[model samples]
Target: MRIVIVDDDPLVRMGLKAILQSEEGWTVVAEAGDGSAAVAEVRRASPDVVLMDVRMPGMDGLEATRLIVDSGSPAKVLVLTTFEVDEYVFEAMRSGAAGFVLKRVPPPELIEAVRVVATGESLLFPASTRAVIERFSEAGGYELPDLTEREQDVLRELARGHSNQEIAGHLYVSVETVKSHVASILTKLGVRDRTQAVIVAYESGFVRPGDAAEL
Candidate 1:
């Protein structure tokens, strides 16, 4: 996978590069020190995934993520944050980031996160992610846009952080069928990935935090 590393901290960038590049199939295509630079580098490199730091000197990752998504770039943004429960991370997700991960996560997990995001799957920390989204979303919930009954079912399972195969089992559908439904959900919701779909599920009250608590 081609990748871009974006962080204000030089040491953090170096460390992440070392770990990610250690994988034979991955390449660090570019590096940027802040959000604006990240945007420029991402546009230039067109990497498959961008490891973006949430807080930076000038433009923050939240806005950078928004710009990247709005600009129709295909690269997925996987936010890198120091705090798992950060509001910035939540906002970044709404801005169309694929997911967020704590900076202190183990090397193997972090690498797996990139792989997941690169594949267009959402990476949820499960506990902390629910906290951030629930804490920040409106309490009363927003009215859901028109979704088919099957799509709604697929989304509720998605909000629970189930893998495609697991959701397939629950719904008694083929894995490819679940994937088709997920793609349709993303398109209908006008969101980039599963992370944003989960946010919509919670905010729409289609799936309550307690409903997904087990995940």
Candidate 2:
């Protein structure tokens, strides 16, 4: 996977580059000190993923993410933040970030997050992300689509953070079947990914925050 690291801290950028370069089939194509530089680097490198820091001296990651996404760049953004539940992280997601990981995340998990986002899947950081979604979704009040009973079952599993493979196993179906359900779910709900779908499920009262365990 090709990646660009964007952080104001030199040491942080270097450390991340070292970690990513150690892995096979991964390359650090570029590095930028701040968000503006990040935009330029992304445009020039055309990387598959960007590890973007939230706070910076100028043009913070949230704005940078908006510009990148609005510009229709294919690269997915994975925001890096020091705080676990900052409002800026939520803003980053709204700005079209694929997901976020805490700065203190373990190296293995960080690498895994990059791989997940690179593959066009949304990364949900369970505790932190779910909390953010719940708080914001409650305010926005999502509207549910006309999903069939089986689709609702699939959505409930999705809201619980189950993967396509895991959902298939739980529903006694194939992965491709789960993918089909997921696509239909996205289309019906008029959302982008599973993360947004889950948010809608929660906001629309299709799936309660506590329903995951009961389902």
Best prediction by lDDT:
1
TM per model? 0.94, 0.88
The Cα local distance difference test for each model comes to 0.86, 0.83
Can you write out model 2's per-residue Cα lDDT over 74-136, one digit (the tens) per residue?
A: 889999998877788877877788778888988998988888878755445566676666566
Model 2 deviation from native, Cα RMSD in Å: 2.2
lDDT by residue for model 1 over 56-158, one digit each (tens)?
Answer: 9999888888898988999999999888677788899889988888899999999898988888654466567677787787646677778899988899888
For each candidate in turn, give its C-alpha RMSD to the true structure in angstroms.
1.5, 2.2
Prediction 1 TM-score vs. true: 0.94
Write down the TM-score for model 2.
0.88
* Local error of candidate 2 at residue 82 (angstroms): 1.3
lDDT of candidate model 2 versus the reference: 0.83
Q: Which stretches of candidate 1 lie over 4 Å from their true place?
A: 139-141
